[model samples]
Target: MIASWRPGREIRYHTSLNEALANPAPLVLALDGGVFPFRGALERLLSEVQKPGVSLAYSSYETDSGTVEALPFNGDITERFPFGPLRAYLSERLIPTGAERFRFAWEYHARLALEEQGLFPSAIPEPLYFHAPDLLPRPDLREYLDSRQCQSGPDLAESFAYLRYPPEADAEFREAFYAMLRRRGAFLEDLEPERTFPPGKGENEVMASVLIPVRNRESFIAQAIESALSQDFEDYEVIVVDNASEDRTRDVVRGFRDPRLRLIENPPGSIAFALNAGLRAARGKYILQLDSDDAYTPETVSRMVSFMEENLGCGLAISYYQLTDENMNPLPDGVVKHLEYDRNNILRCEGAGAVRCWRKEVLLEIGGFDEEFGNYGEDYDAVLKVSERYEVCRVHKVLYFYRRHQGSQDAVQSKAERLNAKTRIRLRALERRKKLVQNRGNKRNTEGA
Candidate 1:
């Protein structure tokens, strides 16, 4: 297919390696089974490619998920081809051509290596391409599980979407590859021995504590408070950290005559600050997260607490949640399977726990939530820390309700800010990996001497 915006241009065609070789043009472009609506995509891509030290070039594109995706390119993550349609390659480097520069397996690493041989890969800000994941038949968890292709930790492998391999690769190979990465310290690694909490049955001290951090969420605060108060796990305490709510949130919370509801007021600041305040005052061994605008089912606390108690190694636990509209109406099939535990890309772990419940001591040990991250993506950073140091578990039950409203950060954060925040998160993970590698080297040297 020819990538052109001019009138009467042939934008669609089927070609083989022979046809591409026959073409006299220096560059060959391939598009998914869709039309290229972006006009300057080709020009902009070529311009960047022609730069003195540029190798492969790509453009940011919008995904079917209503998010503008321009994932930060990394060699390790490239092997999985998570780029989806965000990238295009030098045709000669692809399969059946010269060196088979690109493939379903090693496209990212090979092209990135090719760039390293000369100039680096280049990117443009335009949404040059459109690719929908639904266009292809992807294997669901059932297919992966039934295939019996996952011999190594099939439980975790099948749970995550990206880990589900096609029939081409056997279970052993994928599992071995995963083990190698885990050993290399890039993927999920257990925290140092000293970091784990003591294993004693320290009082079922307060059983569980529900932390609700809010500011100006009057309309929703009462429902959230009641949800916490009505949990089947009666031993739990409800600690509401009020962030100077000007709305009727304070009055509504005060209206609750329940003695188990502990309300602490803090100055107007970041949500992290309120969370920290609530966490500091929590008396329970485990903490349940309750946003002012979202609620928990009565069974949520009990179910999540059981999961954590059963999985002693897990530091934090999250579960499937029902996504409802502002009016509590069912919103399509928004079932969350917690696919964030990719074991490869840490970024995918953002949803490690949409509704998080952490071991109080472990949460405190990790320094709790960083007030520096402000309110946006604060939980994500904390989850990443927990995942780095300890295992994160996902309960298959829909124990929580997430109401998608206009006030939520997911609905209000700008595209640029989302990208920027994700980029920062990625950098942090990378830095953590670097430190781990250095520490491993130091330990080896010490042992040798």
Candidate 2:
């Protein structure tokens, strides 16, 4: 019996994608919730998928924000979901493996399976459907990982490469996944021995420098300074690199009477520029990150300093943080402890965490943060460079308060632009990692011969 009726076609709805793929229909159209097709959506998708070597086809869609262009498919769907509400697949191309276990993101898993088989999706650049604005969440790792108990054999192997193992993953599964990464040349087996710090021109007593870069954040600048000063650690200095603020941010920073707090005046420039200035003026052995609009926990400085001192091989470290509103009240799902963070999978993710601390020599050697990213992805660029050689470790405690307010940089930046900038960083990291792995293989071959 026909489960549902569509215009000029009978729709058989299956609970799982596996069942649908098992029974071949010449063409398959998958619609996400709240997706209303435009007049010619199906025709356009069908026309595109029928083309030679095209296994899947998808079109852009209209959202409350605007028309989201069908992002160019690069055959690597593991990094992100580029398709929108409407996706059409050639029935013969969809692999039944790994499709049944995914309660949510099943389509995503199917796309990954297709990608592994060298089947890439074709894109139609125009809007073909209306996607509900409220349906904004991408496939979540936790939601998919929860279904792991039901997965085994080929299904598990197909999904394993894209999975980020948090502490929540079973011990056996985590170990096996890590072993796979090592064999695939994606994982670094061990950290390099500790390197010597750059020689100091003069004697400096500061062990850590809490670097705060500001532009027009007068309201919260004082709180940030206060929190830094409140640190239990004594051998640390607080350096505020003021980026020619039009507001009273400079005045508030000057009001601080502590000798350890110093403000450096800089011309209007990118956040990276301000940060580089802070790095130059910093007298501490380690540079700690503290945004002008965010405050650190009292133990933040002490904990980070101790970790860096104890772990000689670690060049950079980031601590977990609490996501709060401007009033410091915790937002829903506020505690951001990125337990899924692994050095091997850093290429596939965003930055590790906030309250990042880096060895001064390591920052200098990597030429500091890349100013090309402007304010958007400087931290991630730096993180990628540092992690390539030295260890990038995590401090498991929440030692910073990340306040989300209208005045925040992320709040003001265009979402599309920010996403584009981050995607560029990820692509660059991918190339760099590929080169590194290739070099390692060549070296091993030479040594064996």
Question: Which regions in candidate 2 have their CA more than 4 angstroms from the true location?
Answer: 1-8, 52-55, 62-79, 95-125, 132-202
Candidate 1 residue-wise lDDT at 86: 34
- Candidate 1, residue 357: Cα displacement in angstroms equals 1.7
Cα TM-score of candidate 2? 0.80
Q: Summarize candidate 2's per-residue lDDT along 28-94 as a digit string, tens digits.
A: 6665544555555566666787777776788877666677887776544233555665578766565
lDDT of each: 0.64, 0.73
Instruction: Return the TM-score for each candidate structure.
Output: 0.72, 0.80
**Local distance difference test, candidate 1:** 0.64
Q: How much is 165 displaced in model 2, in angstroms?
A: 12
Candidate 2's displacement at residue 36, Å, is 2.8
Candidate 2 residue pairs in backbone clash: none
Q: Per-residue error at 53 for model 1, in Å?
A: 3.7
* lDDT accuracy of residue 168 in candidate 2: 43
